[model samples]
Target chain A: MRCPETDNQELLVAYGAGRLGSRETAKLEAHLAECEACRVACAAQATVWKALDGWEAEPLASDFDARLLARIASEEQPGWRRRWREWLRAVAARPAVPAFAALFMVVAGFWLLPRGAPPEPRADAALVREIEIIEATLDDLEMVKELSGGDRGEGARSL
Target chain B: MKTGVQQTVVGVAALEHDAQLMLRVREGDQASFGLLLEKYRAPVVHFLYRMVQNQAVAEELAQEVFLRVYRSRTSYEPAARFTTWLFRIATHLALNWLRDGKHERLQERLDEEGEGQTVRRDVPDRRPSAEQILLKRVRRDEIRAAIAALPAKQRAAVLMHKYQEMDYAQIAGALGCSESAVKSLLFRAYETLRARLRRLA
Candidate 1:
């Protein structure tokens, strides 16, 4: 029989834990009888297991359940402010929300502008043409006044 | 018939019951959540206490574990045993706490409290002599120190293996590792413990 320590160490652990079946236990016992090293290893593991068994956990605090339930209740009924903040955070986490917001802003800007507002260059050209037209009209009025001024000049002189 | 198979069947049935309760919680059944909490609260606290070696921190972490369970109830699936999922949450929190190096200062406080609690708990019924109590305390301290000295993963593996009585597969599920890795961890951990505590036998 091979040494369990080398071939199958988990067997030693299971054996020490009393988890091995009767057949495997008998087999390991035979190996332990012939092998001093396996014997030492098994004994040591069993001792370690026993020492661990002595380390019992302390009793839980009596108010553990009460405290946990209270926390859960508080979580379930967070203040409106906190809920609002959480809602904002959840909204902020989604890529689509911000993207949609930006697109909406762009669309809104286009929609809110005056329908008849002209382009900047076209408005500048129109203003220049109006100024030229006013200048040309003023020249025509000056020419008419000159053409009628000689007779009026003579009449005023006579008066 | 194998005992392992029998235990697996039993474990599955128990987990199925827990899953049913959790499903009810998903549907807003507060009473079902309470039932699950009442059933698992002690084991979770005890496991965390053993892992962190501090009572206060263990209780705090246990609260977080349950809170997470409740918060995630909406997505609860019965793909795995509830114990596996619960312990996985627990083991993750404990490992994080240890990794953060928060346990160093608390260990001294634990030393002070742990001795008193152990003595008080033992004194009630058995009424062992003073010398015997002192001896037992010494042995218990040695065991705890030996376990604490192990690497965090190894410590978790050994605790689940020995105290929690979890088989390797369950431990692997909780630890998020393969069964072979868990076996290796236990092998190394037990080897270290035996070296430190062999004289106690």
Candidate 2:
């Protein structure tokens, strides 16, 4: 094995486990010839491989298959039927895009229906104009009172 | 009757004679689901118990996995090996349970308190006596403990390799990595196992 690195021992161990490619193995073999350490590494790796085969799985519990299948059976369903129904539901779910858009616009417009329009003149502006007219009338009355002061007795009776 | 179709049915039948009830669960069959529990209640419960190292959490999580399997029944495919799939699900749940960081190991010692106080024997002088069996069990336990000591990836690689007889490719799928990575995982796992088993050797 052409060893790629001193670290190739670990990789060689992996190689022995069938993990490494042939090129990697060839490289490791090349290293093994040149490096005594790698040979020892391969040997050390051999012991573990031997033990690994003897590591049997624990016995399955007596009822393992029974329960596992029961679960599968309970979960069984008609493959195509479910798919078909789902397909139909999907087809039924669609509405034309423009129809949907129109519906949405209608709902939005209903919510946004405008408030009552303001009059031509606002209430505050009308109030200010009325105040100006009243002030002019008060001035006019004051002028008339001054002019009529000489004839106050007869005018007062009429007034 | 010996036609391939007949054989297929027979195969599926033999597979389910014990757990046919579980088959019903996929069909939303509650009765079949109940029968499944009747058949597999112990194994499922104990498997989780061993997996999580906690009886209560195992029981709870086992129930959840079952519910999940039940919920996802419509997509169930029978083409694959059932035990592998089931254990895959179980393994995933157990791994998630371990996200809390090896609760099962700590709990195992606490639960077995006063039991392993002595230097347990794993191998005997070979006459195959009662002592030999006891020793064998102890050895197995030690090996198991060593296996448990490995990092999660190595432990899974080893367990899947050993217990599941999965090829490195299948392990790669379960591990969500490349086949080469799985090989490295197994190699590291073996290195650890060898070191631990050497004293017993």
Q: Number of the top candidate by DockQ?
A: 1
Best candidate, TM-score: 1
How do the residues A31-130 of candidate 1 rate in per-residue lDDT, one tens digit apiece?
7888988888888889988898888988889998898887787677759956776688799899999999999999998999768857556587889999
Per-residue CA lDDT of candidate 2, range A1-159, in tens?
Answer: 434464554575565566678898897778778798677556656655555555444344565546545545444547786567667657667777557778989999988999678867669988999999999999999999977885887777898
Instruction: Enumerate the candidates' DockQ scores in order.
Output: 0.54, 0.07
TM-score of chain A of 2: 0.36
lDDT of 2: 0.65
Report clash pairs, candidate 1.
Answer: none
Worst 10 residues of 1 chain B by lDDT: B116-125
Shift of residue B180 alpha carbon in model 1, Å = 1.0
For model 1 the local lDDT of residue B34 reads 92
Error of 2 at B196 (Å): 3.3
| Candidate 2 per-residue lDDT over residues B48-73, each given as its tens digit | 55555456676666666666666655
- Isolated chain A: TM-score per model? 0.46, 0.36
